[model samples]
Target: MASLAASLRDPAYVFHFLTPSFWSFLIGVVAAGSSLFFLALRADEQGEHFATSHNRDQINEAIRAMPEVVASPKRLADEANQGRNELIRQSHEKHARAQRAWARSQRYKVGWAASLTISALAFVLGYAWPLAQLSFFGAKLLP
Candidate 1:
Protein backbone atom coordinates (compact mmCIF):
# COMPACT_ATOMS: atom_id res chain seq x y z
CA MET A 1 0.00 0.00 0.00
CA ALA A 2 2.89 2.38 0.79
CA SER A 3 4.57 1.50 -2.52
CA LEU A 4 1.30 2.18 -4.34
CA ALA A 5 1.05 5.57 -2.65
CA ALA A 6 4.71 6.31 -3.36
CA SER A 7 4.33 5.38 -7.04
CA LEU A 8 1.22 7.52 -7.28
CA ARG A 9 3.21 10.47 -5.89
CA ASP A 10 6.15 9.77 -8.26
CA PRO A 11 5.32 10.05 -11.97
CA ALA A 12 8.51 8.11 -12.91
CA TYR A 13 6.97 4.96 -11.47
CA VAL A 14 4.09 5.33 -13.94
CA PHE A 15 6.56 4.92 -16.80
CA HIS A 16 7.83 1.68 -15.28
CA PHE A 17 4.27 0.35 -15.13
CA LEU A 18 3.54 1.22 -18.79
CA THR A 19 5.94 -1.21 -20.47
CA PRO A 20 6.00 -2.42 -24.11
CA SER A 21 4.35 -5.68 -23.10
CA PHE A 22 1.52 -3.73 -21.48
CA TRP A 23 0.95 -1.79 -24.68
CA SER A 24 1.02 -4.93 -26.76
CA PHE A 25 -1.53 -6.55 -24.43
CA LEU A 26 -3.79 -3.51 -24.68
CA ILE A 27 -3.58 -3.42 -28.50
CA GLY A 28 -4.19 -7.15 -28.79
CA VAL A 29 -7.27 -7.07 -26.58
CA VAL A 30 -8.77 -4.16 -28.53
CA ALA A 31 -8.08 -5.83 -31.87
CA ALA A 32 -9.55 -9.14 -30.72
CA GLY A 33 -12.64 -7.48 -29.34
CA SER A 34 -13.19 -5.59 -32.60
CA SER A 35 -12.79 -8.78 -34.61
CA LEU A 36 -15.35 -10.54 -32.42
CA PHE A 37 -17.75 -7.65 -32.80
CA PHE A 38 -17.51 -7.67 -36.61
CA LEU A 39 -17.80 -11.44 -36.64
CA ALA A 40 -21.11 -11.16 -34.75
CA LEU A 41 -22.40 -8.58 -37.22
CA ARG A 42 -21.49 -10.85 -40.10
CA ALA A 43 -23.30 -13.77 -38.47
CA ASP A 44 -26.42 -11.73 -37.83
CA GLU A 45 -26.44 -10.42 -41.40
CA GLN A 46 -25.97 -13.95 -42.70
CA GLY A 47 -28.98 -15.11 -40.68
CA GLU A 48 -31.12 -12.27 -42.01
CA HIS A 49 -29.97 -12.99 -45.55
CA PHE A 50 -30.72 -16.69 -45.19
CA ALA A 51 -34.22 -15.91 -43.99
CA THR A 52 -34.83 -13.51 -46.89
CA SER A 53 -33.12 -15.56 -49.61
CA HIS A 54 -35.85 -18.18 -49.44
CA ASN A 55 -38.40 -15.57 -50.39
CA ARG A 56 -36.34 -14.10 -53.22
CA ASP A 57 -38.79 -15.04 -55.94
CA GLN A 58 -41.66 -13.37 -54.16
CA ILE A 59 -39.54 -10.34 -53.41
CA ASN A 60 -38.53 -10.01 -57.05
CA GLU A 61 -42.13 -10.24 -58.13
CA ALA A 62 -43.05 -7.45 -55.72
CA ILE A 63 -40.28 -5.25 -57.01
CA ARG A 64 -41.50 -5.77 -60.59
CA ALA A 65 -44.85 -4.23 -59.64
CA MET A 66 -43.46 -0.89 -58.46
CA PRO A 67 -45.84 2.11 -58.58
CA GLU A 68 -44.02 3.85 -61.42
CA VAL A 69 -43.87 0.71 -63.51
CA VAL A 70 -47.52 -0.16 -62.85
CA ALA A 71 -48.76 3.37 -63.58
CA SER A 72 -47.23 3.49 -67.06
CA PRO A 73 -49.57 4.04 -70.05
CA LYS A 74 -51.19 0.91 -71.49
CA ARG A 75 -49.20 1.28 -74.73
CA LEU A 76 -45.87 1.40 -72.79
CA ALA A 77 -46.77 -1.38 -70.37
CA ASP A 78 -45.22 -4.14 -72.47
CA GLU A 79 -42.02 -2.17 -73.05
CA ALA A 80 -41.71 -1.34 -69.36
CA ASN A 81 -42.20 -4.96 -68.38
CA GLN A 82 -39.50 -6.06 -70.79
CA GLY A 83 -36.97 -3.58 -69.40
CA ARG A 84 -37.92 -4.39 -65.81
CA ASN A 85 -37.49 -8.09 -66.48
CA GLU A 86 -33.94 -7.56 -67.72
CA LEU A 87 -33.09 -5.37 -64.73
CA ILE A 88 -34.44 -7.94 -62.31
CA ARG A 89 -32.41 -10.68 -63.98
CA GLN A 90 -29.22 -8.68 -63.66
CA SER A 91 -29.96 -7.88 -60.03
CA HIS A 92 -30.52 -11.54 -59.28
CA GLU A 93 -27.15 -12.42 -60.78
CA LYS A 94 -25.43 -9.80 -58.64
CA HIS A 95 -27.20 -10.95 -55.51
CA ALA A 96 -26.18 -14.57 -56.18
CA ARG A 97 -22.52 -13.52 -56.44
CA ALA A 98 -22.78 -11.65 -53.13
CA GLN A 99 -24.37 -14.67 -51.46
CA ARG A 100 -21.51 -16.89 -52.62
CA ALA A 101 -18.98 -14.49 -51.16
CA TRP A 102 -20.81 -14.44 -47.84
CA ALA A 103 -20.89 -18.24 -47.76
CA ARG A 104 -17.12 -18.41 -48.32
CA SER A 105 -16.40 -15.95 -45.53
CA GLN A 106 -18.63 -17.86 -43.12
CA ARG A 107 -16.92 -21.12 -44.02
CA TYR A 108 -13.52 -19.67 -43.12
CA LYS A 109 -13.79 -19.25 -39.32
CA VAL A 110 -10.01 -19.34 -38.79
CA GLY A 111 -9.55 -15.55 -38.86
CA TRP A 112 -11.57 -14.96 -35.69
CA ALA A 113 -9.99 -17.87 -33.87
CA ALA A 114 -6.49 -16.79 -34.86
CA SER A 115 -7.06 -13.25 -33.59
CA LEU A 116 -8.35 -14.54 -30.23
CA THR A 117 -5.39 -16.88 -29.87
CA ILE A 118 -2.89 -14.09 -30.61
CA SER A 119 -4.56 -11.80 -28.04
CA ALA A 120 -4.36 -14.54 -25.40
CA LEU A 121 -0.67 -14.96 -26.12
CA ALA A 122 -0.16 -11.23 -25.78
CA PHE A 123 -1.91 -11.23 -22.40
CA VAL A 124 0.38 -14.00 -21.17
CA LEU A 125 3.46 -12.17 -22.41
CA GLY A 126 2.35 -8.97 -20.70
CA TYR A 127 1.87 -10.75 -17.37
CA ALA A 128 5.15 -12.69 -17.57
CA TRP A 129 7.48 -10.01 -18.93
CA PRO A 130 7.38 -7.84 -15.80
CA LEU A 131 8.07 -10.77 -13.50
CA ALA A 132 10.88 -11.95 -15.74
CA GLN A 133 12.45 -8.47 -15.73
CA LEU A 134 12.20 -8.23 -11.97
CA SER A 135 13.84 -11.63 -11.52
CA PHE A 136 16.67 -10.82 -13.93
CA PHE A 137 17.43 -7.57 -12.08
CA GLY A 138 17.21 -9.19 -8.62
CA ALA A 139 14.70 -6.54 -7.56
CA LYS A 140 12.95 -6.94 -4.24
CA LEU A 141 9.29 -6.07 -3.80
CA LEU A 142 8.79 -2.73 -2.05
CA PRO A 143 6.72 -2.90 1.12
Candidate 2:
Protein backbone atom coordinates (compact mmCIF):
# COMPACT_ATOMS: atom_id res chain seq x y z
CA MET A 1 0.00 0.00 0.00
CA ALA A 2 2.82 2.38 0.87
CA SER A 3 4.67 1.55 -2.32
CA LEU A 4 1.46 2.04 -4.32
CA ALA A 5 1.00 5.50 -2.82
CA ALA A 6 4.65 6.34 -3.52
CA SER A 7 4.24 5.22 -7.12
CA LEU A 8 1.14 7.38 -7.48
CA ARG A 9 3.23 10.38 -6.45
CA ASP A 10 5.75 9.77 -9.24
CA PRO A 11 5.84 12.65 -11.70
CA ALA A 12 6.30 10.53 -14.83
CA TYR A 13 3.27 8.35 -14.09
CA VAL A 14 1.18 11.36 -13.08
CA PHE A 15 2.07 13.23 -16.26
CA HIS A 16 1.25 10.24 -18.47
CA PHE A 17 -2.12 9.53 -16.83
CA LEU A 18 -3.10 13.21 -16.49
CA THR A 19 -2.81 13.77 -20.25
CA PRO A 20 -5.90 14.20 -22.43
CA SER A 21 -4.97 11.14 -24.48
CA PHE A 22 -5.60 8.70 -21.61
CA TRP A 23 -8.85 10.35 -20.56
CA SER A 24 -10.08 10.50 -24.14
CA PHE A 25 -9.27 6.84 -24.71
CA LEU A 26 -11.19 5.86 -21.57
CA ILE A 27 -14.24 7.92 -22.49
CA GLY A 28 -14.13 6.70 -26.09
CA VAL A 29 -14.17 3.07 -25.00
CA VAL A 30 -17.22 3.73 -22.83
CA ALA A 31 -19.02 5.50 -25.66
CA ALA A 32 -18.29 2.70 -28.10
CA GLY A 33 -19.65 0.08 -25.68
CA SER A 34 -22.78 2.12 -25.06
CA SER A 35 -23.38 2.52 -28.78
CA LEU A 36 -23.02 -1.19 -29.34
CA PHE A 37 -25.56 -1.88 -26.59
CA PHE A 38 -28.03 0.52 -28.14
CA LEU A 39 -27.57 -1.12 -31.52
CA ALA A 40 -28.52 -4.48 -29.99
CA LEU A 41 -31.62 -2.88 -28.53
CA ARG A 42 -32.58 -1.46 -31.92
CA ALA A 43 -32.11 -4.86 -33.55
CA ASP A 44 -34.38 -6.45 -30.97
CA GLU A 45 -37.06 -3.83 -31.59
CA GLN A 46 -36.86 -4.43 -35.35
CA GLY A 47 -37.48 -8.13 -34.85
CA GLU A 48 -40.48 -7.35 -32.65
CA HIS A 49 -41.92 -5.03 -35.27
CA PHE A 50 -41.52 -7.67 -37.94
CA ALA A 51 -43.32 -10.25 -35.80
CA THR A 52 -46.24 -7.94 -34.98
CA SER A 53 -46.60 -6.50 -38.49
CA HIS A 54 -46.74 -9.86 -40.22
CA ASN A 55 -49.59 -11.26 -38.12
CA ARG A 56 -52.69 -10.99 -40.34
CA ASP A 57 -55.14 -13.29 -38.48
CA GLN A 58 -57.34 -10.36 -37.41
CA ILE A 59 -57.52 -8.99 -40.96
CA ASN A 60 -58.36 -12.49 -42.26
CA GLU A 61 -61.26 -12.74 -39.76
CA ALA A 62 -62.66 -9.35 -40.83
CA ILE A 63 -62.44 -10.38 -44.47
CA ARG A 64 -64.17 -13.72 -43.79
CA ALA A 65 -67.10 -12.06 -41.93
CA MET A 66 -68.56 -10.22 -44.97
CA PRO A 67 -70.56 -12.77 -47.08
CA GLU A 68 -73.17 -10.30 -48.41
CA VAL A 69 -70.45 -7.72 -49.16
CA VAL A 70 -68.32 -10.44 -50.75
CA ALA A 71 -71.31 -11.17 -53.08
CA SER A 72 -70.49 -7.96 -54.97
CA PRO A 73 -67.43 -7.94 -57.24
CA LYS A 74 -66.93 -4.15 -56.70
CA ARG A 75 -67.12 -4.35 -52.87
CA LEU A 76 -64.69 -7.28 -52.98
CA ALA A 77 -62.28 -5.16 -54.97
CA ASP A 78 -62.66 -2.21 -52.59
CA GLU A 79 -62.10 -4.43 -49.53
CA ALA A 80 -59.01 -5.90 -51.11
CA ASN A 81 -57.70 -2.42 -51.87
CA GLN A 82 -58.47 -1.18 -48.36
CA GLY A 83 -56.80 -4.19 -46.76
CA ARG A 84 -53.71 -3.74 -48.93
CA ASN A 85 -53.60 -0.06 -48.06
CA GLU A 86 -53.87 -0.77 -44.35
CA LEU A 87 -50.99 -3.28 -44.48
CA ILE A 88 -48.87 -0.83 -46.45
CA ARG A 89 -49.52 1.90 -43.95
CA GLN A 90 -48.59 -0.33 -41.02
CA SER A 91 -45.44 -1.44 -42.80
CA HIS A 92 -44.43 2.13 -43.52
CA GLU A 93 -44.82 3.12 -39.88
CA LYS A 94 -42.82 0.12 -38.66
CA HIS A 95 -40.05 0.71 -41.19
CA ALA A 96 -39.85 4.38 -40.26
CA ARG A 97 -39.39 3.61 -36.56
CA ALA A 98 -36.76 0.97 -37.29
CA GLN A 99 -34.93 3.35 -39.59
CA ARG A 100 -34.92 6.05 -36.93
CA ALA A 101 -33.51 3.65 -34.39
CA TRP A 102 -30.82 2.52 -36.82
CA ALA A 103 -29.89 6.12 -37.54
CA ARG A 104 -29.59 6.92 -33.83
CA SER A 105 -27.44 3.83 -33.24
CA GLN A 106 -25.14 4.76 -36.10
CA ARG A 107 -24.76 8.27 -34.76
CA TYR A 108 -23.75 6.93 -31.37
CA LYS A 109 -21.18 4.67 -33.05
CA VAL A 110 -19.74 7.59 -34.98
CA GLY A 111 -19.48 9.68 -31.84
CA TRP A 112 -17.70 6.83 -30.06
CA ALA A 113 -15.17 6.41 -32.84
CA ALA A 114 -14.59 10.18 -33.08
CA SER A 115 -14.09 10.55 -29.35
CA LEU A 116 -11.48 7.76 -29.33
CA THR A 117 -9.58 9.21 -32.27
CA ILE A 118 -9.53 12.71 -30.81
CA SER A 119 -8.51 11.44 -27.39
CA ALA A 120 -5.55 9.51 -28.83
CA LEU A 121 -4.36 12.55 -30.75
CA ALA A 122 -4.72 14.79 -27.72
CA PHE A 123 -2.75 12.37 -25.56
CA VAL A 124 0.10 12.13 -28.06
CA LEU A 125 0.29 15.91 -28.49
CA GLY A 126 0.05 16.63 -24.75
CA TYR A 127 2.71 14.06 -23.85
CA ALA A 128 5.13 15.28 -26.52
CA TRP A 129 4.79 19.06 -26.27
CA PRO A 130 6.25 19.50 -22.79
CA LEU A 131 9.31 17.42 -23.63
CA ALA A 132 9.77 19.25 -26.94
CA GLN A 133 9.50 22.62 -25.18
CA LEU A 134 12.07 21.61 -22.53
CA SER A 135 14.44 20.43 -25.25
CA PHE A 136 14.15 23.72 -27.09
CA PHE A 137 14.86 25.66 -23.88
CA GLY A 138 17.73 23.28 -22.83
CA ALA A 139 16.27 22.94 -19.30
CA LYS A 140 14.50 20.35 -17.17
CA LEU A 141 10.82 21.34 -17.04
CA LEU A 142 9.89 18.86 -14.29
CA PRO A 143 11.84 16.94 -11.67
Candidate 3:
Protein backbone atom coordinates (compact mmCIF):
# COMPACT_ATOMS: atom_id res chain seq x y z
CA MET A 1 0.00 0.00 0.00
CA ALA A 2 2.83 2.38 0.84
CA SER A 3 4.57 1.57 -2.45
CA LEU A 4 1.32 2.11 -4.30
CA ALA A 5 0.93 5.51 -2.62
CA ALA A 6 4.56 6.48 -3.44
CA SER A 7 4.15 5.46 -7.07
CA LEU A 8 0.99 7.50 -7.41
CA ARG A 9 2.82 10.59 -6.11
CA ASP A 10 5.47 10.62 -8.83
CA PRO A 11 5.75 14.08 -10.46
CA ALA A 12 6.83 12.85 -13.89
CA TYR A 13 3.91 10.46 -14.15
CA VAL A 14 1.52 13.14 -12.98
CA PHE A 15 2.91 15.68 -15.48
CA HIS A 16 2.82 13.10 -18.28
CA PHE A 17 -0.85 12.42 -17.68
CA LEU A 18 -1.88 16.07 -17.35
CA THR A 19 0.33 18.01 -19.76
CA PRO A 20 -1.11 16.88 -23.05
CA SER A 21 -4.72 17.37 -22.05
CA PHE A 22 -3.95 20.71 -20.42
CA TRP A 23 -2.15 22.05 -23.45
CA SER A 24 -4.79 20.72 -25.79
CA PHE A 25 -7.57 22.40 -23.87
CA LEU A 26 -5.62 25.66 -23.65
CA ILE A 27 -4.91 25.70 -27.37
CA GLY A 28 -8.45 24.82 -28.29
CA VAL A 29 -9.81 27.60 -26.14
CA VAL A 30 -7.40 30.11 -27.65
CA ALA A 31 -8.25 29.06 -31.19
CA ALA A 32 -11.99 29.19 -30.62
CA GLY A 33 -11.78 32.58 -28.91
CA SER A 34 -9.64 34.01 -31.68
CA SER A 35 -11.96 32.70 -34.36
CA LEU A 36 -15.01 34.16 -32.66
CA PHE A 37 -13.32 37.50 -32.17
CA PHE A 38 -12.30 37.66 -35.80
CA LEU A 39 -15.77 36.70 -36.93
CA ALA A 40 -17.24 39.47 -34.86
CA LEU A 41 -14.80 41.95 -36.35
CA ARG A 42 -15.68 40.81 -39.84
CA ALA A 43 -19.38 41.11 -39.13
CA ASP A 44 -18.89 44.64 -37.85
CA GLU A 45 -16.89 45.57 -40.92
CA GLN A 46 -19.48 44.13 -43.25
CA GLY A 47 -22.25 45.95 -41.46
CA GLU A 48 -20.41 49.23 -41.69
CA HIS A 49 -19.64 48.69 -45.33
CA PHE A 50 -23.24 47.88 -46.11
CA ALA A 51 -24.46 50.95 -44.26
CA THR A 52 -22.01 53.24 -46.02
CA SER A 53 -22.87 51.80 -49.39
CA HIS A 54 -26.56 52.19 -48.73
CA ASN A 55 -26.08 55.79 -47.61
CA ARG A 56 -24.09 56.58 -50.72
CA ASP A 57 -26.80 55.07 -52.88
CA GLN A 58 -29.40 57.20 -51.14
CA ILE A 59 -27.30 60.31 -51.66
CA ASN A 60 -26.90 59.49 -55.33
CA GLU A 61 -30.65 59.05 -55.66
CA ALA A 62 -31.19 62.41 -54.01
CA ILE A 63 -28.73 64.02 -56.39
CA ARG A 64 -30.55 62.45 -59.32
CA ALA A 65 -33.89 63.70 -57.99
CA MET A 66 -32.50 67.26 -57.89
CA PRO A 67 -32.78 67.45 -61.69
CA GLU A 68 -36.40 66.40 -61.66
CA VAL A 69 -37.17 69.05 -59.04
CA VAL A 70 -35.66 71.69 -61.31
CA ALA A 71 -37.47 70.47 -64.43
CA SER A 72 -40.87 71.87 -63.41
CA PRO A 73 -41.86 74.76 -65.69
CA LYS A 74 -45.03 75.99 -63.88
CA ARG A 75 -43.45 79.20 -62.63
CA LEU A 76 -43.45 82.78 -64.00
CA ALA A 77 -40.65 83.38 -66.56
CA ASP A 78 -38.96 85.86 -64.23
CA GLU A 79 -39.07 83.44 -61.28
CA ALA A 80 -37.78 80.53 -63.37
CA ASN A 81 -34.20 81.79 -63.25
CA GLN A 82 -34.36 82.25 -59.44
CA GLY A 83 -35.80 78.74 -59.03
CA ARG A 84 -33.02 77.32 -61.17
CA ASN A 85 -30.42 79.14 -59.05
CA GLU A 86 -31.93 77.82 -55.83
CA LEU A 87 -31.96 74.30 -57.27
CA ILE A 88 -28.25 74.66 -58.08
CA ARG A 89 -27.52 75.76 -54.51
CA GLN A 90 -29.43 72.77 -53.12
CA SER A 91 -27.48 70.45 -55.42
CA HIS A 92 -24.21 71.92 -54.11
CA GLU A 93 -25.38 71.34 -50.54
CA LYS A 94 -26.24 67.74 -51.36
CA HIS A 95 -22.77 67.26 -52.88
CA ALA A 96 -21.14 68.62 -49.73
CA ARG A 97 -23.21 66.32 -47.57
CA ALA A 98 -22.20 63.34 -49.66
CA GLN A 99 -18.53 64.29 -49.35
CA ARG A 100 -18.83 64.51 -45.60
CA ALA A 101 -20.51 61.11 -45.47
CA TRP A 102 -17.74 59.57 -47.54
CA ALA A 103 -15.10 61.04 -45.26
CA ARG A 104 -16.93 59.68 -42.20
CA SER A 105 -17.13 56.20 -43.75
CA GLN A 106 -13.40 56.26 -44.49
CA ARG A 107 -12.68 57.21 -40.91
CA TYR A 108 -14.78 54.34 -39.66
CA LYS A 109 -12.95 51.90 -41.89
CA VAL A 110 -9.57 53.06 -40.62
CA GLY A 111 -10.60 52.90 -36.98
CA TRP A 112 -12.11 49.45 -37.35
CA ALA A 113 -9.05 48.09 -39.08
CA ALA A 114 -6.76 49.45 -36.39
CA SER A 115 -8.88 48.03 -33.60
CA LEU A 116 -9.09 44.63 -35.25
CA THR A 117 -5.32 44.48 -35.69
CA ILE A 118 -4.67 45.36 -32.08
CA SER A 119 -7.16 42.83 -30.78
CA ALA A 120 -5.71 40.03 -32.93
CA LEU A 121 -2.20 40.84 -31.73
CA ALA A 122 -3.31 40.78 -28.13
CA PHE A 123 -5.00 37.42 -28.54
CA VAL A 124 -1.96 35.89 -30.23
CA LEU A 125 0.40 37.18 -27.55
CA GLY A 126 -1.80 35.97 -24.72
CA TYR A 127 -1.92 32.44 -26.14
CA ALA A 128 1.73 32.23 -27.23
CA TRP A 129 3.31 33.59 -24.04
CA PRO A 130 2.14 30.63 -22.03
CA LEU A 131 3.02 27.99 -24.58
CA ALA A 132 6.48 29.46 -25.22
CA GLN A 133 7.77 28.62 -21.73
CA LEU A 134 10.84 26.39 -21.45
CA SER A 135 11.31 23.69 -18.82
CA PHE A 136 15.01 23.27 -18.09
CA PHE A 137 17.04 22.12 -15.07
CA GLY A 138 13.88 21.76 -12.97
CA ALA A 139 12.84 25.35 -13.69
CA LYS A 140 10.20 26.75 -15.99
CA LEU A 141 11.42 29.83 -17.82
CA LEU A 142 9.27 32.05 -20.03
CA PRO A 143 10.72 32.55 -23.47
Candidate 4:
Protein backbone atom coordinates (compact mmCIF):
# COMPACT_ATOMS: atom_id res chain seq x y z
CA MET A 1 0.00 0.00 0.00
CA ALA A 2 3.07 2.28 0.17
CA SER A 3 3.07 2.61 -3.63
CA LEU A 4 -0.60 3.56 -3.60
CA ALA A 5 0.02 6.23 -0.94
CA ALA A 6 2.93 7.71 -2.88
CA SER A 7 0.89 7.80 -6.09
CA LEU A 8 -1.97 9.61 -4.33
CA ARG A 9 0.44 12.34 -3.11
CA ASP A 10 1.58 13.12 -6.66
CA PRO A 11 0.44 16.44 -8.19
CA ALA A 12 -0.99 14.65 -11.23
CA TYR A 13 -3.11 12.46 -8.97
CA VAL A 14 -4.34 15.52 -7.04
CA PHE A 15 -5.24 17.35 -10.27
CA HIS A 16 -7.22 14.39 -11.54
CA PHE A 17 -8.98 14.22 -8.23
CA LEU A 18 -10.02 17.84 -8.57
CA THR A 19 -11.28 17.54 -12.14
CA PRO A 20 -14.60 15.83 -12.89
CA SER A 21 -15.47 13.73 -15.96
CA PHE A 22 -18.18 14.30 -18.56
CA TRP A 23 -20.39 11.52 -17.16
CA SER A 24 -20.32 12.95 -13.64
CA PHE A 25 -21.29 16.34 -14.98
CA LEU A 26 -24.08 14.77 -17.01
CA ILE A 27 -25.44 13.08 -13.92
CA GLY A 28 -25.58 16.36 -12.07
CA VAL A 29 -27.38 17.98 -15.00
CA VAL A 30 -29.95 15.18 -15.10
CA ALA A 31 -30.59 15.49 -11.37
CA ALA A 32 -31.18 19.23 -11.64
CA GLY A 33 -33.44 18.79 -14.65
CA SER A 34 -35.61 16.23 -12.85
CA SER A 35 -35.91 18.45 -9.77
CA LEU A 36 -36.99 21.43 -11.85
CA PHE A 37 -39.53 19.35 -13.75
CA PHE A 38 -41.05 18.09 -10.52
CA LEU A 39 -41.33 21.60 -9.12
CA ALA A 40 -43.11 22.88 -12.21
CA LEU A 41 -45.54 19.96 -12.15
CA ARG A 42 -46.32 20.56 -8.50
CA ALA A 43 -47.11 24.21 -9.13
CA ASP A 44 -49.40 23.32 -12.01
CA GLU A 45 -51.24 20.80 -9.85
CA GLN A 46 -51.86 23.39 -7.16
CA GLY A 47 -53.19 25.79 -9.75
CA GLU A 48 -55.60 23.13 -11.01
CA HIS A 49 -56.85 22.56 -7.47
CA PHE A 50 -57.47 26.26 -7.00
CA ALA A 51 -59.44 26.45 -10.23
CA THR A 52 -61.53 23.42 -9.20
CA SER A 53 -62.35 24.95 -5.83
CA HIS A 54 -63.39 28.22 -7.44
CA ASN A 55 -65.75 26.38 -9.75
CA ARG A 56 -67.25 24.48 -6.86
CA ASP A 57 -67.95 27.73 -5.01
CA GLN A 58 -69.74 29.11 -8.05
CA ILE A 59 -71.86 25.95 -8.33
CA ASN A 60 -72.80 26.10 -4.68
CA GLU A 61 -73.90 29.73 -4.97
CA ALA A 62 -76.07 28.89 -7.95
CA ILE A 63 -77.68 25.94 -6.11
CA ARG A 64 -78.48 28.06 -3.10
CA ALA A 65 -80.22 30.63 -5.29
CA MET A 66 -82.53 27.93 -6.81
CA PRO A 67 -85.20 27.85 -4.06
CA GLU A 68 -85.52 31.62 -3.95
CA VAL A 69 -85.80 31.76 -7.73
CA VAL A 70 -88.64 29.15 -7.64
CA ALA A 71 -90.61 30.72 -4.76
CA SER A 72 -93.32 33.28 -5.79
CA PRO A 73 -91.85 33.98 -9.18
CA LYS A 74 -94.91 35.97 -10.33
CA ARG A 75 -95.06 38.30 -7.29
CA LEU A 76 -91.27 38.46 -6.80
CA ALA A 77 -90.74 39.41 -10.47
CA ASP A 78 -92.96 42.48 -10.05
CA GLU A 79 -91.59 43.53 -6.62
CA ALA A 80 -88.47 45.17 -7.97
CA ASN A 81 -87.71 41.72 -9.40
CA GLN A 82 -86.46 40.63 -6.04
CA GLY A 83 -85.59 36.97 -6.50
CA ARG A 84 -84.41 37.24 -10.13
CA ASN A 85 -82.41 40.38 -9.42
CA GLU A 86 -80.74 38.83 -6.43
CA LEU A 87 -79.95 35.69 -8.44
CA ILE A 88 -78.44 37.78 -11.20
CA ARG A 89 -76.35 39.75 -8.72
CA GLN A 90 -75.16 36.62 -7.01
CA SER A 91 -74.31 35.03 -10.35
CA HIS A 92 -72.25 38.06 -11.34
CA GLU A 93 -70.43 38.02 -8.03
CA LYS A 94 -69.68 34.31 -8.31
CA HIS A 95 -68.38 34.81 -11.86
CA ALA A 96 -66.11 37.61 -10.67
CA ARG A 97 -64.72 35.47 -7.91
CA ALA A 98 -64.04 32.60 -10.30
CA GLN A 99 -62.33 34.99 -12.69
CA ARG A 100 -60.07 36.25 -9.96
CA ALA A 101 -59.17 32.72 -8.92
CA TRP A 102 -58.35 31.80 -12.52
CA ALA A 103 -56.15 34.85 -12.88
CA ARG A 104 -54.23 33.96 -9.75
CA SER A 105 -53.82 30.38 -10.93
CA GLN A 106 -52.41 31.56 -14.25
CA ARG A 107 -49.91 33.79 -12.46
CA TYR A 108 -48.77 30.96 -10.24
CA LYS A 109 -48.27 28.69 -13.27
CA VAL A 110 -46.17 31.27 -15.07
CA GLY A 111 -43.98 31.97 -12.07
CA TRP A 112 -43.39 28.31 -11.37
CA ALA A 113 -42.48 27.56 -14.98
CA ALA A 114 -40.10 30.51 -15.17
CA SER A 115 -38.34 29.61 -11.93
CA LEU A 116 -37.93 25.96 -12.91
CA THR A 117 -36.60 26.87 -16.35
CA ILE A 118 -34.02 29.25 -14.89
CA SER A 119 -32.86 26.75 -12.27
CA ALA A 120 -32.48 23.99 -14.86
CA LEU A 121 -30.57 26.28 -17.18
CA ALA A 122 -28.19 27.30 -14.41
CA PHE A 123 -27.49 23.72 -13.48
CA VAL A 124 -26.85 22.75 -17.10
CA LEU A 125 -24.41 25.63 -17.60
CA GLY A 126 -22.60 24.92 -14.36
CA TYR A 127 -22.09 21.29 -15.28
CA ALA A 128 -21.24 21.80 -18.98
CA TRP A 129 -18.65 24.59 -18.60
CA PRO A 130 -16.19 22.50 -16.59
CA LEU A 131 -16.93 19.30 -18.51
CA ALA A 132 -15.44 20.74 -21.68
CA GLN A 133 -11.92 20.64 -20.27
CA LEU A 134 -9.82 17.73 -21.59
CA SER A 135 -7.40 16.17 -19.17
CA PHE A 136 -4.03 14.81 -20.33
CA PHE A 137 -1.30 12.43 -19.03
CA GLY A 138 -2.44 11.59 -15.46
CA ALA A 139 -6.10 11.88 -16.47
CA LYS A 140 -6.16 8.11 -16.81
CA LEU A 141 -5.00 7.59 -13.23
CA LEU A 142 -7.77 6.38 -10.93
CA PRO A 143 -8.14 8.03 -7.55
Which candidate's TM-score is highest? 1
The TM-scores, one per candidate, come to 0.51, 0.47, 0.44, 0.45
Q: Which regions of candidate 3 fall more than 4 Å away from where they truly are?
A: 1-79, 135-143
Candidate 2, 27-131: lDDT as tens digits? 556655665665566566556555544444444455456442343678776775676656556656756665665566566556556655655665566556555
Residue-wise lDDT of candidate 3 within 53-135, one digit each (tens)? 56656655665564443344556543645655655566566556656655655665565566556556655654454445433
Writing each residue's lDDT as its tens digit, candidate 4 over 1-143 gives 22442557475664454344334555556655665665666666556656656765776677675654333657754574466566666666766765665666566567556655665666565455443432334233344
Backbone clash count for every predicted candidate, in the order shown: 0, 1, 0, 0
Candidate 1 matches the true fold with a TM-score of 0.51
Error of 4 at 58 (Å): 6.7
Q: lDDT per prediction?
A: 0.64, 0.55, 0.53, 0.56
What stretches of model 4 exceed 4 Å from their correct place? 1-80, 133-143
Candidate 2 TM-score over all chains jointly = 0.47
Ranking by TM-score: 1, 2, 4, 3
Whole-model lDDT, model 4: 0.56
